[model samples]
Target: MGHDHAHGAGGNRRRLGVALAIIAVVLVAEVVGAAVSGSLALLADAGHVASDIVGLVVALVASTIALRPATDRHTFGFQRVEVLGALVNGAILVVVAVGVAIEGVRRLLAPEETHVAGLPLLVVAAGGLLANVAALLVLRGGDRQSLNLRGAYLEAMGDLLGSAAAVIAGVVILTTGFAPADAIASLVVAALILPRAAALIRDVVRVLTESAPRDTDVEQIRAHLLDTPGVVAVHDVHVWAITSSAPVFTAHVECDPEVFEEGRTGPLLDELGECLQGHFDVTHSTFQLEPAGHVDRGESSHR
Candidate 1:
């Protein structure tokens, strides 16, 4: 499992690097086109692409930090760094969207003579769309369960839609003298950004807060442990994720004294671990197997 996780992390890093490079290249073209065409929509899309560049950088750094080995000083190593990065990236998206929206609204109210070169705007936006599609394909195969990767994917996805909108706005501006089309497209891009950014922030916040894995049921876990042959009760049952895909569990189990006497506690513990792994997808677990009434004898250890 550890080896597989490491391999997956390496793949995610490579994908991020590729996507980042692609976005950086396209960003320059979009910026130049926006300046030359004086298209608000194109500029808004460029802003989003810029934010994606920042998001990718943060995701890459966090992915690297998350691979660090655990040490005494940091018991869980730097695994949570990815979650933090996701949160920061999400926040950046929201801020960028807001700024673009404000500018779009201003443009809509006070129409300006945008000397847009329609063909250039269309070609540039189409090129951006193609680049975004390539970046999306690179990130699509990454671990979707990872918040860090998901956040980056969300930004790329938003930019993809924004680029499409820019193409439409450019076409409309060229065919008809509709200057507000550019502002309208910028508004559309902002709309695409808001919800995805909010969701990414919520998910990362849940992880940073150490909430239980979304699929885990504490009551069900307790019941399963109680149904074990030697377990009489289950207490202090806690389940939380160390990373998006890594759930950790620790519990205290009251067991039949006869099982310990007969030297069967080891087998009982093995069964418990297997049950958790098979039924709950919880591979990392620590259980304190105590004979019935042992909790009363060691009050300090109960927790």
Candidate 2:
């Protein structure tokens, strides 16, 4: 809670600007290269670059909104904006991969005119790889804090990998005069993209569904609280991720009436908060204090 989010937002914005510029330049280069060379690999790499461009633009927009001050309507502010952008980005990558697969399948079914020039595609792929690698480094930490950043990084990395695959495929096509190599590389890129898209979808679902933080155990948290002094029992415990990285929890704590009648719950709550923060790494929490026996013996975790 004490961390200054402004620092992170500023960093993200700076990185986003750099990433967008890199993608734009490489994307333009790809279009020219693909048009001139008429190479399937170049076209595929260009398609991957197009995805990177969108992802970077998304990152830029998300970063700008992420820095906005919280409003009553949006108590969590625009942090979730980054997550939305990430989800969109990941989904777009899936679309791109599928599009590429369709093209590859079409080519496999009915072969078309393709100018396989190893040197031309190689030159374009090398430049693309260099730019995308730099973009990847710029977006690394952004992914750690923001979903938008993760999407952007993945797309950029996909461009890098796709370009590498295209280069190798181009070399083989040029050497052996076999056009299928290009389709093979495109298929491989498509396969690679499916798992990454699936993972991003899973992460987004977990966060939005209020699923438990991956590392925390609800029973373990309940036991920790029940062990605290003056605690009669603990119930209605819940722990879940607000985002991939942030966690929030809520619970109802039963306390000894004798001690509560003495108004000693303040210190207890403070101690409990500290314990959870230190031991469980639960950052945001709310607990409804209950007098012993005020609630039923069994309780369920909710919201």
Candidate 3:
């Protein structure tokens, strides 16, 4: 499991690196464009792109750290670093969204003070949209499988929407001379960012709190374990993750006394392991095969 996780992290790291490069290029262009055009929409998109760069950097570093081998002191190695990176990305997204929204509302209140050059904004926004598209494609494959990658992908998606909003605002200003369109577009970008940020943070919090992976059904897992031959009951069944893909499960399985005394323990363990891996996609599992009547001193206190 560790080997497979490290391998996947390697691929994710490479993807993050490529996406980071793409976003970095667009970020510079957008920043300059925002300054030249004095367009709030362009500035908002530029700010989102900047956040994407930061997210990708965090994800990239986390993936690299996750490649490290487990040691005695850190048995899980650095897999949780990916979750931390995702949390940071989520916080950054919220900050950028709120900041952009506040400034956008301020600008909306005084449209006459907004002197955005529509032509420059349009050209830059169009370019930014294309770059965002490229970055999204680079991140698309791994987003569902890794929370860290998903955070980066979500940032890119936000950047894409922001660029699109900027483009629309530019067009409205160019054709109708509506200066407030830029502020409206910035608000739209903020609106797009908030939901995605909320979702990422929610997922990160679940992992930090050691909650089971969302796709996993704990009751079903317990039932499955109980259905194993010779297994009478399963208790203290715990499921959680170090990251999105690295789920871990542990349980105390009560079984018939003959199952342990008659040399059947090995096969039972094999069957349990295979069941978890095959049905639940849980590669790391630990089972304590206890005799049916045996008891641990403090077992009643456990769940």
Candidate 4:
């Protein structure tokens, strides 16, 4: 297929390291501000920043682990660590968002007194906004096709929005002495976190469960294989992702006996491999060339 795939995550790991540092600094600042001002919105924003810190840390570790070389005992060489990290990040975000939502609702009911020093809150939130923007830009140039990097970027974007919300809520409370505004802002931050967390979790589950690539149609693949000359049937076809960008496939292709007799299996195998790689972005595939009714005879079927 002539596609040159970039295999390592070294550059991405460096970027993630930088982003993690920025998030750690901002998270601490937000926590202190939340405590001093007793601002629900600021506290919620701090929680989001904490999530980003965790997400970035996971991304950095996964990226580093992903660069390890393959060994006989671990043939894939820890690449799947990226997917696992993404899953863990997703789960944590959901839990944290739920906690924020509950706190926000409770504050809305009772209206906690917010001694929001508006100018300081604004300054801190603005600084957080700037930091998150910087982190996002740093991660933007990395291999976002990887789920790990994508998760980091998404978390940073969410933190940026949360910071903006905190700034607006701070100004509102300062001007009107309205305490509910802080709670409302916290609710908004929680809403922003939920959908992205759910989506990330779904994607991670798909990969872990060995579901087919979202864009590849199994029926279409079967038809394409059947279209090849000397092929009689296709069975036990399966396609799945090993990571966000890496897909693995295996199938049993039944062909005429004469094709095997004539030592034509090599050319046929090459043609099938090229077809899969070019059409469906499947570079790793295993095909069992067999005579018709191979499955009926108790040949193993992965499907």
Q: Name the top TM-score candidate.
A: 3
- Model 2 lDDT, residue 298, Cα: 51
Give the range where candidate 3 is weakest over 10 consecutive residues by summed lDDT: 36-45
For every candidate in turn, the CA RMSD to the true structure comes to 2.2, 2.4, 1.3, 2.8
> What is candidate 3's lDDT per residue for 1-303, written digit by digit as tens?
777888889999999999899989898998887787665566667767777788789989988988999899999899999999999899988998998899889998887777888999999989989998999999998998789999999889988888888889889989999889888888988888899999999999999999999999999998888898899988878899989888999989999989978999999999999999999999999999999966677775666
Error of 3 at 261 (Å): 1.9
Residue-by-residue lDDT tens digits, candidate 4, 175-197: 88776776787788889988988
Off by over 4 Å in 1: 113-115, 296-303
Model 4 earns a TM-score of 0.89
Candidate 2 lDDT, 28-106, residue by residue in tens: 9988987997765677677678776877787678778877877999886676777777788888888988988887787
TM-scores, in order shown? 0.93, 0.91, 0.96, 0.89
lDDT for each candidate structure: 0.83, 0.78, 0.88, 0.80
- Candidate 1 per-residue C-alpha lDDT over 12-31 given as tens digits, one digit per residue, 9 for 90 to 100: 88889999999998899988
Q: Is candidate 1 or candidate 3 better by lDDT?
A: 3
Separately for all candidates shown, the number of backbone clashes (residues 3 or more apart, or on different chains) is 0, 0, 0, 0
Score candidate 2 by TM-score against the native.
0.91
Of candidate 2, the 10-residue stretch with the lowest lDDT total is 294-303
